[model samples]
Target chain A: MAISIVVTSGKGGVGKTTTTANLGTGLALQEKKVCLIDMDIGLRNLDVVLGLENRIIYDIIDVIEGRAKLHQALIKDKRFDDKLYLLPAAQHADKTAINGEQVKAIIDELRSDFDYILIDCPAGIESGFQNAIAGADEAIVVATPEISAVRDADRVIGLLEKAEMAPPKLVINRIRSKMMQDGEVLDIDEITTHLAIELLGIVVDDDTVIRSSNQGEPVILDPKNQAAQGYRNIVRRILGETVPLMTIHEEKKSFFAKLFGKKK
Target chain B: MSTKNVKLKGTKEGYTIVLHDVASFEEILIDLEELLLNISKQNNASTEISVHVDTENRLLSDEQLAKVYQLVEQHSTMKIGKVQTNVLTKEAATLWKESENVATLVTTVRNGQVVTMPGDVMLLGSIHQGGTLKAAGNIYLFGELKGIVHAGYLGDEDKVVFAKFNHDAQVRIGEQVQIIEGKGKNEPLEDTTFAYVNDLHILSFDQLDQIRAIKPKLGNQTGGLL
Candidate 1:
C-alpha cells in the first residue's frame, strides 16, 4: 500500500508548500512514483512552485466534482515523466467546495498507482486542512524556528490528536544556526520540546531555496546545495532509512560571518 | 380584547409554548397536545418532546404535572423526558456547587501491559499495546483501551472508570473483581465499557447487556490485580 502524507502547518508562510514540492521531487528522484496533491483551493501555488503553472488543465475540485477524470486532471512532471505528477487545486473555488469524503475517494484511486502521495495542506485549521488530512496515513508538521510558528504548530498538533490522527512528525524549517548559537533564535531542540513530536529534518536558511523557487526548481534537484541535501535527507528518512542530519555550519560563511568574526 | 394569544418561541436549549387567557388549564393542555401531535406527524421523527407550563403565576400540583406529562406522551413520536420546576430549593442551590468538580476517570490497557497512567492518575496520550494502567480513582481513555485496567486498585471500591473503546481487557475496580474473559469478540459495537467496585471486587457490564451475571463467590476480599 502507498503511504499518503499530509504536509501541514497551522500558521501561514511556514514553508508547507515548499516542503511538499521538495519532498515529492526528492522521492521521485530516488525512482519512487510520487504524486503531489495541492489542496489549498483558491490560493493554489504548488503548480507554480513545481514550474508547471501553464500546463494545468484540470484541478482537484474538477476531479472531485466529476467535471474531469482523475487521469485528466493529473499533470505529469516533464522532468520525471511518469514518475512525478501534480494534482493541482482549483483557483476559483473556496475550501468548502470539497470535503473529507471527496479527498479520500481521490486518494483511494491514486493509492494503487503511486508509491507516495504528498498532500500540501492549506495554512489554517479549516475545511481544507481536514480534507487534506482525511486520507493521510501519516502527517508532517512544518514550522519555522520562531515563537509564533512554533505556538501555532503546537495547536495544530493538538488538533491532529483530537482528530485521532497519530502523532505527526515535525520538520523545523528555515533555521539559521548562527543566530541559534548566538541565542538570538530558537534552536531545533527548543522547538521540538514545545511541539513534542518526532523530529524529521531541518532545512537551513539558504538563499538557494528562494532562487530555486523562482526558477520553478526545488533545491533537492541540486546535488551540491546544502539545503537540497537536507530535503534529500528527509526523503531518505521517510523511506525508513536512517540518514545523518545535514551539517548547517559546514556551508561557506556569508560576508556577515567574517565581519562579526563569529563561527557558526 | 377577547382575542386569544398563543406564542411559540425557540430558545437556545429547546422550544417554549405559551398560552394566554385560556378558558382553563384543561383547554390549554388539549390545544398543546394537538400542536405537538401535528408537529410529530409532520416531521416523521421519533424524538422525545418536552413542554414547560406556567399558569397564572401558580405552582403546578402533582396532578397537573401528571396531566402535562401524559399529554405529551400521548403523541406517538414524542414523550416527556424531563420536567424542570421553577421553584428553587436549598439542596438544588448546593447541587450546582457539588457538580462543579465531579470528574469521570478512565483507564485503558492494551495487550496486557500498562502503557499509560490509569484514569485515577492524570497522564498524557493513549495507552499503547502491551501496556497496563491502574487508578485509585476514576479512569478515562480518549482512545481505545485494549489492555488490563485496575481502577480503585487500593480497594476503595467506589471509583468508577469508563473507556471509549473497550476490547476484552481485564478490569478491576476494588477487592471484588470478576474476570470476564468470555466476552466474545465483536460483542461491543459502540466500544465503550464502564467498571465500578461492587461488594469489593470489580464488576463490569456492557451497556447493551440487559442481564448482568453477578457471581456471589466474587467478593471484596480478593485484592485487585495490578
Candidate 2:
C-alpha cells in the first residue's frame, strides 16, 4: 500500500510545490515509484516545476469528473524511467470542482501502483486544502524562517492535528543562515519550538533553487548542492532512515576558509 | 384577629418585609397588604419608603413576584426596593458553580485555537504563538506562554494573569493590554510573575507575592482575612 503525504503551507509562496517536486523526485531516485499530485487546481505549477508541463494531456479534474481514466491523467516523468508520475491540476477549473471524497477515491485507486503519493496542496485553509488533506495519511507543513510563514504553518499544523492523520512533520524552508545567526530572522529552534511539531528537515536559502525551478528541474537533481542535500535528507527521513541534519555552518566555513588560506 | 404571616423589620439600608415560608400565598399576600397599609398610614404622606421583600426559603414564580410588587404599589408611601430569595434554580446553580471554579487543562493551545473559560484557568501546556487563552475571571498559568492571554475577559478589571513572562507574548487584563516586548525600562519579569490592571488602570507586571497587596480578593478566597 502506498503512503500518501500532503505537502501544505497555509501561507502562499512558502515553497510547498518545490518541496513536493523535490521529495517526489528524490524518492524516484531511490527506486521507489512516486506520484506527484498537484492539488493547486487553477494555479497548478507542479507539472511546470517537474518539466512535465508539455506532457500533461489530462489532469486530476478530468479524472475526478469522469472525463478521463486515472491512468490516462497521470503524466509519467521521462527522466525517472516509469518510476515517477504527475497528476496535474486543472488550469481551467476552480478548486471547488473537486471534493474530499473524490480526492480520497483517486488516492485509493493509485495506492496499489505507486509506492508514495505526494499531494501538493494549495495555500490557505479553503476547500482545496481540505480535499488535499482528506486522502493523506501524513502531512508535511512547510514554513519559511519568517514570522508570517511560521504563524500560518502553526495554523495549518493545528488543523492537521484535528484531522485523523498522524502528527504532521515540519520542513523549515528557505533558511538564511547569516540572518538567522545575526538574529535578524527567526532561528530554526525558535520556529520549530513555536510550531511545536517534529522537525523533518531544513533547506538553506540558495538562489540556485529558484534558477533550477525556472529551468523546469527540481534542485534535488543536483546531488552536491546544499539545498539538494537538504531535500535528500528529508526523503531519507521519510523512508524511515536516521540521517543527521545537514550542517549549514560547516558548509559555509569550508568555502571561506579555503579562499582565505589560499590568500595567506 | 388574623395571625401574622408577614413581619416588617428595620435594617441599616432600609426596611425589610419578611414573608413566612410555611404560610399560604393568599394568607401572606393578605397580611402583607394590611401591614403595608398600616405602615403607609403611620408614615407622613410626603415620605416614600422603599422596602425589600425577603422570601425566606421560598421560590416565587415571576407572576407571584409581580403580584407582590403590585400589592406593594397599592400603598401610596410604599415601593418595592429589591426581592431576595434563598433558593436557586438548577440553571442558575450551574452558572454560579462555573463562575466560582478554576479549570485545569493539560493540552497544548496551538495556533488558531482559542480556549475560553467561564472562571479562572490553570493550564499545564504551552500556548503557541497565534493561539489565545481567555477567561472571564483570573488566569493561573503553569506552562510556557507564547501566545495571547486575556484575563477578566468579561471586563472584570480586578482579575490577573499569573505566569512566568515570555517577553514576546501579549497579556490582557480586562480593558488593559500589555504587549510584553521586553523593551520597558522596568526590571525584567522573572519566574512567579504576574500581570494585572493597576490602580492607574494601566496593565502592570509584578511578582506573584505582591498579589495580596494588589488584589486582596484573590487572597481572601483561600482562607485569607479580608
Best by TM-score: 2
**Candidate 2 residue lDDT tens string, B58-90:** 989999999998888876567788989888898
Off by over 4 Å in 2: A181-183, A251-264, B1-93, B107-113, B144-146, B182-189, B220-226
- Stretches off by above 4 angstroms in model 1 are A250-264, B1-121, B124-226
Q: On residues B1-226, what C-alpha lDDT tens digit does candidate 1 reach at each position?
A: 1113334446666665555543577676767767766666677765556544444333456898787667666664444444444454567555543332234334222222343332245334445334567665556656655455666676657666566554545566766655545454457556455565545343755442321443233234243231
Q: How many backbone clashes does candidate 1 have?
A: 25
On a 0 to 100 scale, what is the lDDT of residue A29 in model 1?
A: 90
lDDT per residue (tens digit) for residues A199-244 in model 1: 9999987999989988999889998987788888999999999998
lDDT of 2 at B91: 93
* Docking band of candidate 1: incorrect
Error of 1 at B90 (Å): 26
